[model samples]
Target: MKTFNYHSAKDVKEASKLASSSSAFLAGGMTTIPSMKLGLATYKNIIDIKGIKKLSGIKVSGKAVTIGATTKHAEVANSKEIKKAIPSLAALAEGIGDPQVRNRGTIGGSIANNDPAADYPSACIALNAVIHTNSRKIDAEKFFKGMFETVLKSGEIIEAIEFQVPQKSNYQKFPNPASRYAIVGVYVAKHKNGINVAVTGAKSCVYNDKDLAKTLSSNFSAASINNVRVSSSGMNSDIHASAEYRANMVKVFAKKAVEAC
Candidate 1:
């Protein structure tokens, strides 16, 4: 890693103030540290936001569950409140990388990095999550831009994410054996308003499958989408899986998610 100035920020104000084009705010450093080591990313200053007490916790209400920015994956997986309110979310957290990664990774860092195959973004879309930042709030749909991209601005820090509670929900993924990142993941959420089908890992970005959602909203069953043909256009293809294969897995996992729900 290159030399950089490390600053321990005590609060959001300090963290945001330290932010600049050449600086980064470190929460869990799950992605940041690795990128720096690989020379994929470099920063002049590293602002440690984990010391900011207000940025770590879980809050549950009847209508929504609010998770602080620095809340670790393990914390989310183990929270009784999270399991009770959103079992799918807890399952998602528990399925992340591994014990070390889960214990160290934060929800904020994962979402902010916006890795296409990352699990949290799919949950955010399916659960109708709102990302609360120091400046303003952004809907989940507007928050993710593309692979490794997001709408977060310079000097802005995410404070928390609030997910609307659903009547029923489930997540299913075909994980990469070595990394555990999803090759194809689907999250199905049934709400009073309607149903949401969010898909990830198969494309350049996580997105809601409107066609599947519409179909499921009408029938709410795995068989309803059995004949639904998912197009392979714009899907990622590599050594692990082909675009067509990934497209098929989307449907397969969507059905699994619905069945699991």
Candidate 2:
């Protein structure tokens, strides 16, 4: 890694104020450190946010489950509150990468990085999450811009993520064996308002499958979307799987998620 000034920020204000155009807030450093070592990215300053006590915890209310930004994947995976309130979320956390990554990676880093194949983004979408930042709160639907992109400003820092509690929800993913990153993942959530079918790992970004959601909202069953065809257009195609195959897996995983729910 290249030389950079590292600052261990004590609070949100300090972290945000320290950020510059070439600065990055360090949480888990799962992606940031790797990218730097690989020469894919470089930062002039690394503002460590992990030291901020306010940025790590889990809060479960009757209406929502709010997770602090720096909460580790392993913490979420093992949290009794998370398991009792949103088991699907805990399951998703358990499925992220390996034990080391799970212990080191964080919810904020995962969502902020916005990796297309990431598991957390699908849960955020399906659970109707609101990203709480230093500046403002953003809806999960509106937060994500595109591939590896979010609406987070240069100096802004995510504080927490609040997910609306659903009546029933489940997540299913076809993971790439080597990396455990989803090749196709689906999260099905049935709320009082309606059903949400969030799909990831098949496109340039995670998105809600309107057709699947509409069909499932009407019936709320695995068989309800059996005949619904997911189009291959705008899907990712690579060595692991073809665009058509990934598109097909989207439906498959959606059905699995609904059945699990």
Please, what is the TM-score per model? 0.99, 0.99
Which pairs of residues collide in model 2? none
Model 1 lDDT tens row, 1-261: 899999999999989998999999998899999999999999999999999999999999999999999999999999999999999999999999999999999999999999999999999999999999999999999999998999999999999999999999999999999999999999999999988999999999999999999999889899999978899999999999999999999999999999999
Residue range 174-248, candidate 2, lDDT tens digits: 999999999999999999998899999999999999999999977888898888989999999999999999989
C-alpha root-mean-square deviation, each candidate: 0.5, 0.6
Candidate 1: segments with Cα more than 4 A from true spot: none
Measured with C-alpha atoms, the lDDT of residue 242 in candidate 1 is: 100
Question: Which lDDT values do the candidates have, in the order given?
Answer: 0.96, 0.95
Error of 2 at 20 (Å): 0.9
